[model samples]
Target: MSFAGFEDDIGGWGPPVELPTGSGDIVRDAMRKEQVIKEILAAQDDLRALLSRVNAVQGDVDKLASGNATLQTYIDNLTMQMAKRR
Candidate 1:
């Protein structure tokens, strides 16, 4: 006997009805949505920049590791030659 705004017996309103215009709420909502979109775009750009930095750092790490390996191999070969001569 008291299901005035509800759709079914779940006792919950289905959805909020749109109010009459000229109340400035529509403008406010639009501005809020725009701000949120701008913030999201800015966040996305920041993430992209961070990822690029990480990739660059990874490349540097790889290069250092490769250089270290190469240097170690050369040193080992030189040491073996000196031992054979002596």
Candidate 2:
């Protein structure tokens, strides 16, 4: 009825068993995984901010293109008037 020679011990089980040596390594690995996840999330936020800025720049560029088109039309009209005067 005895297992490994400690059956009579108060707990009816043997003395505390030593955990496998790799137990601490398991905890460290979990911590590393969590840190990696946090870094990935921060990078995602940065990418989102960068995307927002890019979108804003695209809007400004579109406005500038429209303004340039208007200026070109105005310049062409003025050239025609000058030629007529000459």
Q: Give the TM-score of candidate 2.
A: 0.69
Q: What is the TM-score of each predicted model, taking all chains together?
A: 0.65, 0.69
For model 1, state the Cα shift of residue 39 in Å.
0.4
Across 27-55, the per-residue lDDT of candidate 2 in tens digits comes to 88788889999999999999999999999
Error of 2 at 68 (Å): 0.9
Candidate 1: residue 35 lDDT (0-100): 95
Clash pairs of candidate 1?
Answer: none
lDDT of 1 by residue, 22-85 (tens): 4469888788889999999999999999999999999999999999999999999999999999
Best by TM-score, which number? 2
Model 1 poorest 10 in a row by lDDT: 6-15
Query: Which residue window of length 10 is worst by lDDT in model 2?
Result: 5-14
Every candidate's CA RMSD? 7.0, 15.7
